[model samples]
Target: MDSVRTCVACRKRASRTELLRVVVHEGRLVADDRAVLPGRGAWVHPTARCLDRAVSRGSFPRALRVSGKPDAGPIENRLKTLMDN
Candidate 1:
């Protein structure tokens, strides 16, 4: 069976495959499409609404247990790409 994860942004539980996994890499947020990145990952829906909510509420750092603010540009770009496809 697929694992379950919670969206840090919406605070809703869903299957891991239904959410996007994000990790902090070099102080920046990166999308873990393969779910193979090293470090703690925070899951959120791929939709822009969830992404905006996550960023506005400061859920990334808290969920990933990182210090200060990690850059969200990379993940934002990734989400845009996903939306385009």
Candidate 2:
């Protein structure tokens, strides 16, 4: 069976393949498309709406169990690229 995960922004439960995995790396938020990154991960829908909501609500730090906010620029850029394709 497919694993399940909750989207940090929307707070909706969905299959792991249906969400994008995000992890903190080098003080920045990185999207793990292959879901193979080390460390704790927070899942979110790969869309601008979810990304914006998560960032605006400061969900990453809490969900990832991090202290401060990690730079979200990298993930934002990644979402943009994904949307363009």
TM-score of each prediction: 0.97, 0.97
Which stretches of model 2 miss by more than 4 angstroms?
none
Q: For candidate 1, write residues 1-85 as lDDT tens digits.
A: 9999999999999999999999999999999989998999999999999999999999999999999999999999999999999
In TM-score terms, which candidate is top? 1
The residue-level lDDT of candidate 1 at 49 comes to 100
CA lDDT scores, all candidates in order: 0.97, 0.97
Q: For each of the candidates, give the backbone clash count.
A: 0, 0
